[model samples]
Target chain A: MDSLAEELIQIKREGAAAVLATVTGADENGGVEPGQKCLVRDGKIRAGSIRDWALLQAILKEAEARLKEERSKLVPFDIPGTQGKAEVFFEVLPSPPKLIVVGAGHIAVPLVKMAKILDYHVTVLDDRLQFANRERFPDADEILVGDMAETLKGISITPWTYIVLITRGHKYDEPCLREIIHGPAKYIGMIGSRRRIKACFQRFRDEEKIAEEVIQRVHAPIGLDIRTETPEEIALSILAETIKVRRGGAAQSLSGKQ
Target chain B: MDTIYDQVKEFLDKGETVAVATIVSTKGSTPREVGAKMVVTAWGEILGTIGGGCGEADVRREAIEVIRTRKPRTVRVDLLDDISSDSPAVCGGIMNVFIDPWWKEKEG
Candidate 1:
């Protein structure tokens, strides 16, 4: 691999966001040529051979907008003070989606394993060091042992983060849910029985006065109703629900009997 | 394990240039969504797929040409016309594929 390719692999491994700009077309006298490229990370040009002073400045400015939206596109740019009309394709490489599993109990063991299989940046946390150790979660990216709510408050949550609350009981899960309920997580699912979830939402709605829409966002009684019995089956259902939420799928039966 | 970049890196490590064809944008009902990619080696071997059928074949031809010239170009693939083809990939949509050549020389 070349230095650029090596850096790209490292960037992906670290799950860093970046934009790769490639000039696909340009006028001859425009001082920019096709196939010229530049790599942008953290609002600066990190690599690539696009060395034109004006073109680099233009690309840096446009790359920021592309990275902000996390959308790749074929964009046309007309450089200032030059007759350079070029079409550059900005490819946004967003960070991988993260999975934060709170309360490393029985369900969490299989949940963490499945999330890792789905290529999530899995973080398993619990109050008990015995439960939240590497012995059980060998594939977890982070094994956090601390107060569940406090740990959740300390950790950074992004739109790509998926939080699962499968604590020992409602008392443990409630505080953890409160910490991340208003945050920017993409999906927030709490494991509990329907009656327990209803009482919890009632407390949030009446006592705390949390909005109905806000409480509605929490996927309590989490997981698709596939009549899950075992921990592994429940874990699979939860992951399937998260996938449905993330990818906008209609949860129809795929029994394939038809 | 199915990362196209990893395969591209492997080909580059072997001193063989390859073309990375990416569907940058699509209109109507294409088989694959935008950002679907296929890596075409200089020997016309493909790693991933941007949807199979006549459209992919056209892109493969252009990808090899991109590798030979070591230049990047965008090929507009029209899947609207070929509805009678045997391949199930025809979805009556138009997709713009950007074929970019990758090699060791482009690096710093």
Candidate 2:
């Protein structure tokens, strides 16, 4: 499958919740492009792009304000160099310590089932209605309907939130990460081989100019050092790491008491 | 069950020193499993529920006694006997309640 499709599938399986912030407004200086979108998941930028750097800076500022107030809405912004109607849309996807699994892929299916059993408020996000249906994910708290970026727009990522990105490939992972990295999620993990992660991190650093520190926060090659090879074992490792981060414990130790 | 915040607020407003018994966990077929709560005062006033019936009534009585003595205790009520003799419930569940008392402070 295509990378975007693959990434979408992975996200669905892992239940990574995020927010989609779209730039619906531009100033006279064209601070924002008409259709620019940014995905925010796990307190980080996940995917899509805001054409205008200045506009994104401003939007990030405003988005931070809205986040503090715990409010979500369609915000309009005027272009810098022109006198036109404001046309920007910013949607906040709020996921608590709650987990939002996208895709329901082989990896995500088990993840969602396990998260629910652990008492997390879990949501499943998938563009394909068939994949996101309740029968497929009976334990899910919500089965969202829409595209990865668009569906993610409705979620809010709090400190209590944890996101696992096991998307099929670079295509879905890039945009999802671009959107999510800016929010306040506690943990953001991605499943990939060492080479894939190295390349992805390199792109973020070289092209996106995302600080190395920020990029380092991401747990790529996701999960603990359990040497898991199967989907279920991989899910267990990932969940274990997530639990460790959520409880403010080190990943090396399974028992959080110490 | 109602929200604990609301229940606590209502109990506080009535000028009652109440013993709140919360069922934090349960096993088997217990009536009102985990999170079930009951509030009882030293003067015999009761509010909320912890598997109401003779077992509940007995719990309330014990709670009032706890309040009078200012001590905390965990009481186990077996519903099987109570259901056949005094209470209306026939659930055959046992409830273990941890009774804690709350009171308003007077002026210094």
Candidate 3:
């Protein structure tokens, strides 16, 4: 790969934020043509072809704003003495994280609210109109009332999409789980009892011929074992597990004594 | 990985110059969000999409110029230009697309 493409890959692998600034509009007098670009990571020019010292410095200063908002923008900059203006497009390279809540029950209500606070693009889905309406999920980015299993098949599942199956029982969860078991989701957690999950896995293995390793991806008996007692606490635990997966954190108490 | 970077890397390896067009900003409403990208080859072939329609077609024309000149440019697509048409690109918003060229490094 070329250096710029290689740098792009490394940034995504590390899950680090970087900015790609491309000069999109420039007067002929400015000399810098549109499309001349640079990549800034950690406040340094990691890879780029823009050689203007002043323009590079301007990009370094503006990159922090793009990263803070986590949004792409067209920013205009004027060199110290240049007469014309140059508009540069800053493309934030971090893919926005998304959450797909499979059931719009009690746990999902708080879960959707909390996920939105964490800046996740949250979607709530269920098979019943009474349960999956806007009144209950005012903060949800999207809500769908349809066949839970079939709706999942149509939705695009990306590596950044986190799926949580908290249906009333395993019968509902099982159908949804089968649709996305081997798909490319960052996290797939289903709520169930330990014994019930074991039986479900056995059936999946014997009858459906799914690989054990693939079945292992599902976080059955989902959530961090924080001794959750209420639906609110359970929702917090589920969100915590997804955070740990995305940030690569060990679920350890941050104290001197264990 | 389904990133556009991987596709760009493949084309660069083949010694082909390509233009990567990205929607940097939008006002009012837009078909695609910011950072949506589409890759245009020298032959005007498109790999991804930035909300296809007359707007995308306009970007394609500029992308060819970007590939030929090896110069980056920003094209402002006015979705309001043709509101009477049934094209889905009529979002009644304006968007700015930055088209940049990509090629293998010159052996230094």
Candidate 4:
């Protein structure tokens, strides 16, 4: 294999995020010609070609825009004193965001696995040591055993974090939800039946005095309504919903209705 | 078949130029949905399948071309084309494939 292809494979193995720039035209100096590729990571030029300093500078500006947009496309530019259109391919490879599944119940198992398969960094948290073992969640990046709320105390939830509550029961779900609801997680969900959801909302409304709007943020009865019955199927449904919410997609199902 | 990561790593370790074809989007009844990946090496060896059959063949050809030219591209393959006469597969679907080639950089 060529060094370029080899390096790309290495990047994929290490799960590195990078930007690839390809030149499509060049000036009289033969710099920044068509079909040249460059690899950029962490704001630094790693490899590939755009030989001319001016052309590289121009490509960098366009590369930054492609990275911000997280898009891979041919961008056209005109080199100084050059007549031809300099079209270069700018491809951004952003690391997959982390998805923290706060409960390691039956639902959490599939969710963690599915998230990993989808290239998300997955962490499975549970107070039960047996349930939160590596054997069960081989794909998880981390498995934490402790009080859900307390364990998450020091961990700041970012805009990229995905928090799901599939704890053993409502006892664990409510406290965890109460704590994380105000955090910056991009997606939050709790698995429960209709009655359980109603009861949890009542407690949140009456005892905790949590506003209805805040409670509404929780995706109770989590997962799309595919009438999913099995743990695996339910996990898929929840994942679909979480992706929809994260991608700013409408919450309504493809079958229509919320 | 080897896992996506394993196959990709193997190709890279061998120092072969490779093109990664990811099924970024799909419509109708394509065999594989989004996120499915296929890797094609410079020598025409394939490590995975975006769907299989002619659809995969077309992607393989395109990936080889990308590797030769060191260009990253997205190609739309129609699976519903007539297999017998004009086109490749008749799967009755379409897929948008992103073909990205890997490269090395000199660190200063």
Candidate 5:
């Protein structure tokens, strides 16, 4: 394979977010040609055929925005010195979203399984090895056994990460929430009853002085209003909520509301 | 990890010219979103799918031509004509797919 193709495969396998910008149309004498491409990863041009320095910089800036939104589109770029315009298609390859299930309980087993089915990089964590073993979470990418909140410190929390706080109790869930409440996780969900969740948020607001907006970001009493009963159903509901958040869906039923 | 690029890489490394067909833009009610891709080999074998039915078959025919000629072309697939038919590609939408030729010599 060519070096650029090989590099693209490596970037995808490593689950890195990158953008492939291809020039699809160019005005005559534009100094760019159709089918030319540049691969941008981590704000650097790792490979491709585009050569103009000015165009590369412009493409890099636009590529960053596309990667951030995780959307791909055909964009137009005007040449630096002329009326020539180059139409570039920016294709965003987002990394697999990480689903960290923080409590290897009954719900977690099904949650990990469902998340794996959805192609998430699933990680299961617990304070007890007996609960967080390979037997319970065979498909999980990482089975971590440690103090849940402390272990969270070791994991890199990016905007692609989703944290599901389903620990044994709110005593455990709250501390874990504190560890990541200010971090960059795209979704933070905690399992608890309405009353308990209210008390927990009150504590976070009054004692910890956590900002109200940050505290409100947590999806307490997590999952959609699906009236789920079984463990598998609950897992499905939680994942459905996560998917809604990820895809920006309307979260409405197809059957219509009567 | 299962990108059409992976399949394209495999074909190019074997010294074969492959046609990479991508759904660059889509209208309404299509089966798949834009950026959906499929790789067509010189022997007319497909690695992925850009929806199915007549739209794919039409693209496959054009993809074969793209492989033979080593030239990229855009195909406009209209599903509105088959809306009353039983074809699965009849989603009442139109999409423009760009079929590009990729080989070992082509960089980026």
Candidate 6:
């Protein structure tokens, strides 16, 4: 077998998501020993010390679920063909989340900055060259200048992608939202007022015939209800809401709950 | 960006063993989250950190032994005793660190 260290180095170099399952403990049956490992990537066993085909299949299934959730956990697995269990730790190594800011406006400035600090692979797209440039967004991983909605169609939207529509007007934002609403993006948030959002959703229902659950996936008025008063504060609230969604947090104050 | 694994690859290429210490689990208010890792050389050189301070020091000591013996072990790090101490790692929590020896033969 190839070196596990080499496999890990490759995973990091490729910026790909993978799971490292290690046997931490085993029952008296001695079916497995501690430190036995398997490297799972893209739903396949890339390499490792695990020799049991049945155990490898089980690890692959669990690794896929863990990668989707983007969490590392320790789980006990029943060793097939044996009367014992193996305690395995699934260490999830995920690539950085991609954030596509569909507008290079005021909120995009702070939003891109905050997302950079949070280690997101941020891309800022705008139709206006002046609004989307290196001068304004030095921290953004990618500064794209093109039609916002049309440009979104060219980008690959995966489950690890987050789309934030903060265009200058609904005419721009709505189209961008429509482009990604039914795509694979994990989070799609559009900036608008309550009345405007309601109208937009009505249009989706009446004109587009979009499902309610599909419309619900979008965070229309984008951000947590933190009574944000400034652009920076709004950016913070949006990122907070995004984190809440990513980590599955309640988004409620720990001290008091409603 | 010199990742921890990149450094581990360097040592493994030299046919040397290094100990990787990872916080597999934690209880209470630990300084770092689970899966935080640090690499330690056989000569006691350290790369990265697992919430430095007394808990880290203890893990470092055990890590060297793991490298020497080529064995893997788990150590429970307790920070409840030094709650009032000035150490920044005194997060009033406990964590279990799994130290595993990695060489050229083993996958990183």
Best by DockQ: 5
> What DockQ do the predictions score, one after another?
0.42, 0.01, 0.25, 0.18, 0.60, 0.49
For each candidate in the order shown, give its overall lDDT on alpha carbons.
0.85, 0.64, 0.85, 0.72, 0.87, 0.86
Per-model TM-score, in order, reads 0.77, 0.51, 0.57, 0.64, 0.94, 0.94
Q: Write the per-residue lDDT of candidate 2 for residues A2-30, one digit (tens) a residue.
A: 22223333444455544445443344455
* Native contacts recovered, each model: 0.48, 0.00, 0.50, 0.04, 0.46, 0.30
Alpha-carbon runs more than 4 Å astray in model 1: A28-30, A51-69, A81-84, A104-110, A128-146, A153-156, A181-184, A191-258
lDDT, candidate 5, B1-64, per-residue tens: 4777777788888999988888888888888888888998888898888998889999999999
Cα lDDT tens digits for candidate 1, B1-108 = 335677788888888999989888889989887778899999999888899988999999999999999878889999989787766988989999989888976753
lDDT of 6 by residue, B1-108 (tens): 457888888988888999888888899999998889999999999899999999999999999999998888889999899677887779999998988888887643
Docking class for candidate 6:
medium
Docking class of 4: incorrect
Window of ten residues with lowest summed lDDT in model 1 chain A: A249-258
| Sort by TM-score, top down from the best | 6, 5, 1, 4, 3, 2
Better of 2 and 4 by TM-score: 4
For model 5, residues A1-258, the per-residue Cα lDDT tens digits are 277778888988898999998887788967988778899999999888999998999999999998888888878899777678998888899988999999999899999999999999998999999999999888999999999999999999999999999999988999999999999999888998888988999999899999998987788788877888999998998898888778776764211111
Q: Sorted by lDDT, highest first, which candidate order results?
A: 5, 6, 3, 1, 4, 2
| Cα-based lDDT at residue A65, candidate 4 | 67
lDDT of 6 by residue, A95-206 (tens): 7789999889998999999999999999999999999999999999999999888898899888889888899999998988888899988888888888898899999999
